[model samples]
Target: MSRTLINRLSHARRPLLALAIVAAALGTAHAGYNVWTGEYTFTKDELQSAVDKRFPATLRYGELVSVRLSNPRLVLDEAGNRITTRVDAALSNTVIPSPPVNGSLALNSGVRYDATRRAVLLDNPTVQDVEVQGMSQYREQLNAIGAVVAQQLLKDYPLYTFKPEELRFNGKDVEPGAITVAPDGIRVQVNLR
Candidate 1:
């Protein structure tokens, strides 16, 4: 064995070990920093604007009458790992040969992500509560009225559509996997692919 070669090898081993340690530390930090987890929150006002745009201000059941929605309010809930939304609307109905009927409508709905449709859907909106002002004479018809209004209002509406280009991570679009309804707003959890 040559003494010079052995001495050179021994000196090189220290730097090699140091380089390996530095590489490991850098890898750990990169992994920690590169975790792409983010939530997109949709505020109440934003949802209201969307609803206003998607649905009409006045809907008619027949030629003789029409209902108008005003002062829309939203309440969000997280149930069974899904989103449940309730919309409270001030309703004003105008009927021919009658003045007008004013009331409040509480529309309860479940929100779900439809994989096949690639959209966020509001499913089966039902009237959780209905308040009719100055209509005590027709109390028995309140539920029926509310149900019809709800059905007509939210028949086939998609609250959100997944545009792969819109949801992005690191300048590349990502797909969202889950949505949660919170008190403050709706949160969409995006996955980085």
Candidate 2:
């Protein structure tokens, strides 16, 4: 549910890489059959751009407290096979004349491929922590509200999508099959449809 980052990635990431080009016969070694497998790697910068579009969001709680979240910084967790995001937050409770509370939030999310959309999206995302500067008293409430808002804003958020040309190569219709979260980037293997 964010702006398309594939246009840029389509130019940088290679798809449908021929992994095994074994020759059928010794004489035809140079003309090996084409293996239509694809690998899509998403850089951190590309992922960040996808996370940035859904920002500057506002959600009100209990008709008094309102939370505004923005500037989501996404960190890839190859070990956990997920992404951790930190966002700047502002909380304002109309019950008092106090200024908005400033803080940050840490959220972790797994990635999955949506065939219908032909894109990789956030899966099972959760807000792990919330830190509000000078507003420890509201941390508990803010955390609760942050999770709700994050779910609303980030649920099914698309990280990357394959372009039409990238999906089709040598007369094969390919789709995303395997998803790997790695240190360098998120890699997706395209499977023939």
Evaluate all candidate structures by whole-model CA lDDT and list the values in order.
0.62, 0.75
lDDT by residue for model 1 (1-193), tens: 6999999999999998998887676445433122334555567666666666644367665565566666566666655333333343444445535656677777777666676666666778787777768777766676776788777776546776765544554477566667777766577676665
Clash count for each candidate, listed in order shown? 0, 1
Which has the greatest lDDT? 2
Best by TM-score: 2
Each model's RMSD to truth, in Å? 9.8, 13.6
lDDT of 2 by residue, 12-33 (tens): 5544222222323321431212
**Root mean square deviation (Cα) for candidate 2:** 13.6
Q: How much RMSD separates candidate 1 from the native structure?
A: 9.8
User: What stretches of model 1 exceed 4 Å from their correct place?
Assistant: 1-38, 62-65, 78-96, 167-174, 191-193
Candidate 2 Cα errors over 4 Å, as ranges: 1-37, 137-139
Instruction: Output the worst ten-in-a-row residue range by lDDT, candidate 2.
Output: 25-34
Minimum summed lDDT over a 10-residue window in model 1 is located at 28-37
